[model samples]
Target chain A: MRLEEKFKKLKQEKKKAFISYVPFGFPEINMTGDICLTLQEAGVDAIELGIPFSDPLADGPIIQKATNWALDKGANVDLFFEEFSKFNKKLKIPIVIMSYYNPILQFGLKNFFKQMKSLDISAIIIVDLPLEESQPYIKEARKWNIDNISFITPTTSRLRVKKIIKYARGFIYYVSVTGITGPRDLSYSQLSKHIKNIKQNTEVPICVGFGIHNSNQVYRINKFSDGVIVGSEIVRFIENNYCEKNFLNKLKTHTKNIISR
Target chain B: MKIPNDKGYYGEFGGKFIPETLSACLEELEIAYAKAKKNKNFVNDVNFYLKEYAGRPTLLYSAKNLSKVLGLNIYLKREDLLHTGAHKINNALGQVFLAKFMGKKRIIAETGAGQHGVAVATVSSLLGFKCDIYMGAEDVKRQSMNVFRMKILGANVIPVVTGAKTLKDACNEAFRDWVTNVRDSYYLLGSVVGPHPYPMMVRDFQAVIGKESRTQILKKEKKLPDYLVACVGGGSNAMGLFHFFFNDTRVKFIGVEAAGFGLNSLNSASLSIGKPGVFQGANSYILQDKYGQIKNAHSIAPGLDYPGVGPEHSFYKKIKRAQYVSVNDKQAVAGFNLLSKTEGIIPALESAHAIGYLKELAKKQKNSLVVVCLSGRGDKDLDIVRNYNGIKL
Candidate 1:
């Protein structure tokens, strides 16, 4: 299935996409497949598989800890690709790889995107590759048929929003706050105003991310945005519960609670 | 000499590879910095502070004793004599003056060896702006004196407890702060690293060292020095001295990097053995694993303990305009002791790396004049030195 079809399908069903994020190799490379399967089983529309980077400037403490823990356990791109290749045919939802630019840039963009394309990865979110430096990634991603998910923050100027939506693919990641990825008490009315402002400019579906943690926030975001991207909150939970006896069960319950009923 | 090509690329190395949240802020900074360079009052303010306050035209002392010991004509650019005990105050005063110009109330920075942190704190205090410094927790423990100095200077020193607890992590935390509070706070970046305007701006602020060195060298020796040397972490002091001589084809540049254990072992020798990659916004030679996870940089001198260097340094390396070498921790400590005993100057461990390399350079030629930038004073490093040599006194 194409990346846009997922959003179209969700829109036709009058439902919002509940995209749950899990760092691909949070505990270890092998554990990621199981974690994704569990999240899928718990009823997520898509998986935002975060690749562990040494320097995640856009991340907060929770995701930073998770990334460090993942890296300490010997997480590498080859292992991630090998693991994902095993479960590629089985994945029911789209896999959007969220990573910083360095890891993939060093991995060789051509080879990395080829593997991502073969694995049927729908999109990629390079947190550090802002629009100006994104030309190289955009060119490479287009050739490989991978959707380039761009970010639109509250701070993004109106002129930039117009420029971004012109070439925007898959969905626009509407950063809910001006800060890094972590839970924050965001004003819904203000967020709604920004979201509506962005919505008016683009036909591309938008998902609100960064600090949307609870069912209440999820429910509120679903009323407007096409999807809700739950990142640091879920990563924080796994950091606390990854070693628990019933980790999968806890994750399922936790994920189910946040998805709008 | 002309670089960054309007889009800020120093030979395919530096660019504004930042986040969207900070894009407008960076663009604003770029425009403001461009104008600030042309603004007569801004230029006067920076020059005035550099002259009247930070003690510009620091002595180009001919180190005759050290020169006789190494069998080479050695000249020392005594940046250690500057206020705040390093060349860092030059950039700090300039950046904060710009912050004052732009009406920013808060000034924030990241530090490794604490020289830059102390400099920023000093300037922030002098300028009466609210100040916060992010230093690695490990650095806070090591450079405890500098930490205290920052606090007493009326700056909030925030310890960064993430990612090897060193310079890189502190930089990450500082970027997070800037990203969050970019509107109200001015990120007074410490070195010639980071994105576009930072490397260019910091170098411009610090170019006074080279500017002064050139004039002083000619008056004393009747010719430009054959070689210029300075230690490289993020390459601020190095760039400060090197950029002015870029057009002086007769002069050669050498950047000394800290080889913590050895280049083969744990080290911070980015230009020596690092691969080209992006980290902390700029594309530079970064010490990383094959999979691109940035490796922890190790150095006894906290300042040079970074895995990445300035993009401009990488450009110089690639274009063969400059050469880079490494000195081990033991060699650096040896350099520290040799300079103290021979010249009565205790060089910072970072600067000692360059001093240590002089022994190697002395072997190549005789009677050639070489200038080494003593980038900072070594008072903050006394604890580390005592511990290294097991000296009770």
Candidate 2:
């Protein structure tokens, strides 16, 4: 199902959407499929599979280290598709591929989109691609019925928010902080004000990310926004427990703990 | 000669391709720069610093000895004589002036060869603003003298040890800092790379080199030089020298990129072999693998050890306005030695790439008037050169 349909279904069920992120080849290349399944079974509404790039300016040190390790483990665009294809058919939740534009451009946009479409990927969130430069990609992705997500930040002006939401699809990613993605304290009052302003402009579901670590943060964000995205915290957990005997169980436990709130 | 379009595109090569958090900051900078460009008082302040502090209108000298050897009337635009010993001061001074105008009390910058770092530090100290410079750990060791120069000038040099341990990694770190500190901090970018206003602004500040060279050459030779040449790292010096003569169809432009071992080997000559990709915010010619991961670039000159060129250079190359070529480490070393011995001048390894190209151009273009931008002095490179020659400096 398309992301919009899934959001509508979740709205009917009255369950807050829970999103989780993991680099495609993090911890180990072969473990990506298992990780995604664990996230799905742990009650994540969607999965954001990060395609590792050499320079990830939007990521924190933890994700940067994971990406570098993934790259060293021979992760590439093709490798991601190969691994993702393995379990995409069995996955129930929508999957969004988050990547920097360079890899997609290098992989050939048409081919990359075709591969994503074939694998039943729901959307793509290109971190570095702002609205002014996203027309071509958005137009192309639309042809494959793939949603091209747009990001709105705390620093984004109201006028820009209106302009961005006009082209926003799948969902709007609301960066909870004014910095690279990592855990930090969030002002619940300020966040509510920002999301309220954004909600006035569009009916699309708004997802809050960046600096969300524990269940309390997720619960607070879920109250103000339609969805909560947990990335670096999960990546950190995977990093800390990848070699442990009950790695999957621990990761699933942590994932369930955050969203269960 | 066409400037970037309204969206900051130079024929699809330049744009503000950063994340959402930086959008407002970049917009603020763009608005401030636009206002500053037109404000007479701001213009006067920058020009005053250019003349009195950073040594503007630097001399254009006839390299008599080198000219005799090359058989061409070779003239050097003496940016090497500018304060901070390179053309980087031109941009650094202008940006710091803008930062002060905007009420930013702290500045952050990224450096590869340390010239830009030193220049930024010099201006920050002079302007009494706190400064932090991110440099690759490898560059910190390779250009230790410059690292010391920056430290003495009152800038904190942060060594970045990630991803190839080079310029690209340093840039990544600086971007990380700017995104985190966007409210009160100014990112004083050093080259004609990065997002929109940066390529445009840095080119404008460094355009003084071309402006002075144009007038000086006209006064001295009674005509514009038949050719212009400069080294291209992120292409500040080349853009500084070439922007003025861009419309002069009679004047040929050449940019020399460092071919570390050779172009076939791991090298920094992005314009020659790299494919077009977005990196460090600009869509330019970048060395990347088929899967789009940036490749590690190598060069004896730390300043030239980058896998990408300025977006403007990519536009110029596409329009056939300039010719881009590569010179290996050996040729650059030879160029360094030749200039020191024949002219009593020690050109920086980055600048020597331009001089190295002149050897070939001189052979074919005898009797022609040619101007090369001697971008920097070689004092910081003395140790590297000495090490290359098996001598301790």
Candidate 3:
């Protein structure tokens, strides 16, 4: 099924999709499964499982720390799948493993796709893998029935937008800011205009990311896009307050508060 | 002789005492570096580049006119004469060569004033590796010559529009890129900051400055300098020069951080005003608020406007091996103008911070020999100077 159709289906059911991004094997390798379970239990609609790579260019200070921790615990492709296998029980949300191309290449493409399919990853967002450079991976992802989430930055030209929107399966990641993934002021009119442009160009669901930090930004973004992603801010929250006894509940509450009407 | 704990801590300043999330990564690097350093071949390879490519053993030139003007002898550690016109090349060469030795094929780096990007790109060009440089959009605009230089060297320069669109955003972007592409790429940090290995490795590479200066001073004056002066952005050049004299209590090391307006005003004098905290990996003195959140640091010299200083420099300041001083924009400009007219050497605005304090120090101290690190040439800063001088170039 196309990601656009999936997004529309969720909306028709009056369900808002929540995509949680946490570094793979963060805090500790043992903590990975528990964090996933907590997110799944807290009613996360979808999960973007980030395989912690040492050199993450699109992340912020919080995610950087998470990547460092994950790498320190000997997290790699082997550990990634190993961790995923621990959550063998049925998950509530669609699990999408978000990673850069280097790790996948290191693991070998043929085996990687096969593992993703077996692990039941619904989608993949390979950051830095532009459409022009992603033909082989996209083909493999499609063969495995794994949806490919394409990224479109504010600086992305109109022609590039059309190409990405035409082929994107799960959704089109609209980078609200012009730069790397972090918090900044959103140009609502520009964003809405871009959304409308994408809506006009293709049928894919548009999900905005790269700086929807506070509740106000989420509420604002929720009105315009099919779904919203809060990666760095949540990562920052975890960094600041993860060890607390009520951390999971606090996260759930924060999510609820942001999406509340 | 002992490697400062696993955290790379040097007297509480260099610890990787971050949140648990990054501890593993730091440990991985620590182990890797320990092994890498032991490999004699790796040391030789990095040393080869240091000698051949970065124009190592940079000269110790006596600032003849400045000495005459101030009535005190002043010698300059000419890091400005390095391959990329700054001391940044020394570390870039070392780090990138190490990346190649580690079998990493791709390089990702961040730049503020673009000196580091230019240096990294220049090294990557020679190493035949794919290179990506993350720079703030504002920095790209301000340092367009360097942007052009990096692009010409075949490195992809990605403009980061996040945050204030300065060094901090560039750092964030670089970290994000690293998180995504860690396996096949190495993050070439611009200074002696970041996680373990980087701070130590960069300092080791840049330490040649002090090594050369110490020898030159002994040969010329038959003694060590009474005072060593250098500007601190992330404190690389300062660290390089001061590390050799660290044990020498007689040679006073004075590091001038940019006080944008003043220390009390908005500025990047992190060492003077900042409190200790864990940021970007290492525990160091950083410009932070009462809540311990990193504060925005401002400076006219783009290179000196960092929110934090190197962990080693922070430690040195705490223990009094080095004294941290702040130089404001007006003073730096005066220093720049003075050096250009008197010495015919246009030092980088970052280096001007140290120069800015020299006149006052010369006046205060009687017959004291001062060695200031001219960390970079000012060719890239000519445009900014032209604007400030109101003269068409």
Candidate 4:
């Protein structure tokens, strides 16, 4: 299914989508397929499979540890896509491969997009590839019908926001932070202003990330944007609740309560 | 041939394992470093600063009586004579100068022993750029003198409180700041570890040690010393002295790591006991577990307590051009006292590791010439050692 359609489906229920993110094959690569299946079964609106890169400056220690574990397990583009390809048969959730441009450059962007498309990845968010420098990749990815998502932050001026809006497709990732992603208490006033600014600048669905950790942030996030992305917390959750079959069931019930409210 | 562009990988030791957001910053730094290293103007400008500002060609004084007592010919490279009393000034001057040339308006670095912090503050003071230094809370408390010096020099010393409150935590906090403010800020890493261009770039800047040592040692002895010794924390000073001798089979390089109580006790000897693993985005020997989790590194000397060594040191050790030994805190303190009274030079606690090994080398090898890198002065360490020694000023 198209990436936007998944968000649309969530909007039909008048609920903000829960986009779960995890470093693909973290802790160990062997557990990736299981995690993907678990998230899919848990009714996650979409999934961003974090392709672990060696130098992830935007992540905190928790995510950094997750990436390190994934990298240590020999996680790379080839292996990531190889493992991701296994999910094409069983998982119905739209998978977006999240990574930095260095790995893409190393893998060659054209080839990387091609591989992403071939592996059935519906979207991608290159965190460092701002709209100004994304024309070539966007154009190429467009040809394959893969969604090229863009991001905006509190620091982004309206002029820059318009540029991001112009290039944005699939959905817009509205980062609630003016800083790197991590665990922090969100200032409701600041987050509301950023959300309002993004809504004014873009026509696409907006999903806020970078500080949404628990059910409280998830409920608060619904007032600002169309969806919420919880990355570090979900990784933390999986790490803390490793090997428990009821983990997914509990998370699903918790997420359902947050969104339903 | 072009050097590798990867910022934090050293024979599988250094690479960027940071968030996706900072990859572009690391890439930009990699490009800037490559361009600067190749530029003749940059090279000549850095050379001029080394000569004029830092007082290059610091004397290689022969410790005749001390050598006689130890039964070995020990020579001091005397980096303590440099403007900042440590070799950190070499890298700070090189990088801060590069930042100015690159049009960066701010300088940021992390300090453990505070030598690098003061060195960075010195360069920033001279260059007219805003400077920020992240030091561990523990280090700030211990090295309060250097903390005062940095603040007096107009650099903000931010105390980092995370993960044992030490050098590694300070580095993490600095990197966190760099990712956010990298557009106008240049991260002047104090050592030769971290990702790619850093190890190579720092080694290039401090390579002046090897360059000057080559000319000085040859002029004085008409030959190289049998062994070159320096203390290793992140291994910049040792690498600086050893880089020139890497290809020279005639000279042997020795790196002394702090053993705390001893290697048998808690200490930070990543090179001595660590296996190949990745941390903070570089590949080299690191203190890590079987699952690749970074373990806590211990050492009484805050400067030598780091969990990893520089990439070049790892490379040199792999090729067998360099050897590393661990010296305990008790031995290092004794070495510090011996050097101070015997030679009238107050070596930094970190540099005392080199002296500790020198004492052992003097007993084992008779009439052998050795060049010991006096990497820093001990003025900042006086308070810590005074309390440890139970002596009033």
Candidates sorted on lDDT, descending: 2, 1, 4, 3
DockQ of each: 0.82, 0.89, 0.06, 0.13
- Each model: TM-score of chain B? 0.99, 0.99, 0.95, 0.95
CA shift of A167, model 4, Å: 21
True contacts kept of 4: 0.12
* Candidate 1 lDDT, B68-140, residue by residue in tens: 9999899999999999899999999999999998889999899999999999999999989999999999999
lDDT of 4 by residue, B240-272 (tens): 998877668989888999888666667888889
Top-DockQ candidate index = 2
Clashing pairs in model 2?
none
Location of the lowest summed lDDT over 10 successive residues in candidate 4 chain B: B1-10
How far residue A237's Cα lies from its native spot in candidate 4, in Å, is 12
The CAPRI classification for model 3 reads as: incorrect
lDDT winner: 2
Runs off by more than 4 Å, candidate 3: A1-261, B1-3, B17-25
Better of 3 and 4 by lDDT: 4
Displacement of the residue B242 alpha carbon in candidate 1, Å: 0.8
